[model samples]
Target chain A: TQLLEQSPQFLSIQEGENLTVYCNSSSVFSSLQWYRQEPGEGPVLLVTVVTGGEVKKLKRLTFQFGDARKDSSLHITAAQTGDTGLYLCAGPNNAGNMLTFGGGTRLMVKP
Target chain B: NAGVTQTPKFRVLKTGQSMTLLCAQDMNHEYMYWYRQDPGMGLRLIHYSVGEGTTAKGEVPDGYNVSRLKKQNFLLGLESAAPSQTSVYFCATGSIRRQPQHFGDGTRLSIL
Candidate 1:
């Protein structure tokens, strides 16, 4: 079974629309991270939430870490075509060494 | 700075063939990891090294091996390639266990 689960494996929306992606797990994490990967490219770090119930915002992107540290969410406002890519969520293992990744959510914003 | 790089962006191999994927990092990181990305399967760790001369298995370690002879280089080897091993592989390097990892574009491999 996958330790982390991501919802809406695929999402396509209009340029001005808004969307949110979720990552859930039964296990608690020391920290959770979000990444975005473009076609033919590797994933780039977007944000990292270390505290439970912490919320961070990067320009138009907002990220939230569950109070229990067992889940997280990424919400994008005024989505643009440039926001198109695969969004991935990961959390460091209980040992705080290796990371376990979610399945991933692909987002496409058509202009 | 070429945070991390993988050689031969793409490759095709036949079953039973052996090959090695090289990952180099300029970040001078102590930890390096190898992961395979497959459609609908996400990224599964194949192997990882905490430092030079040390290696550990990840989520998926069967049919694959790794080595970290130097601080800046990590290599993944496939003794006998199989169709099941076909997928896009990624290499990552990090300064600390909790720090964000930098990734290489990826190596697209296909075993016929």
Candidate 2:
């Protein structure tokens, strides 16, 4: 099984709509990170949450880490067409130098 | 500076053929990783290195091998490619703390 699992594998919403993607894991991580990947490009770091029950906002996107550090969520408000891409969550492994990535959530904002 | 660069953006190989994908990073990171992405699957780690001259197996290391002879460069090699090995390969460099990572575009490989 995948170390991390993401919900709603595919999400399509109209422009200006709001949507949330979730990532869950059974293992605890010191920190969790969110990344967005566009076609023909590599995934880009969006935000990182180091504290349990931490919340971070990046422009129209908000990220939250569960209090247990086993899950995370990314919410985008007033979504735009440019938000169409893949959103992934990752956390460090037991070694702290390697990472285990979530399956991924594909988001599409129609114009 | 180029954050991360991958060579031969795309390639096609016949079954049993061997090839190598190169990844270079300029961020002076101490850790590097290789992952493969397929439809419906998030990226799966194939191999990783904490520093020069050291490598470790990841979740999905089968059919793949890696070498990190130099800190700035990491290489993934396919000893004998199979159709099941067709996927997009990505290389990433981790931050000092390893929370977030910087990734190379990707190398799309096809084995027929």
Stretches of candidate 2 above 4 Å error? A95-97, B97-100
Clashing pairs in 1: none
lDDT of 2 by residue, A53-91 (tens): 999999999999999999999999999999999999888
RMSD (Cα, Å) of model 2: 1.8
Error of 2 at B20 (Å): 0.9
DockQ of 2: 0.66
| Cα lDDT of model 1 by residue, A8-110, tens digit | 9999999999999999999988889999999999889899999999999999999999999999999999999999999999988877657889999999999
- The clash count for each model shown is 0, 0
Report DockQ per prediction, comma-separated: 0.65, 0.66
Chain A (candidate 1) TM-score to true chain A: 0.96
Best model per TM-score: 1
Worst 10 residues of 2 chain A by lDDT: A94-103
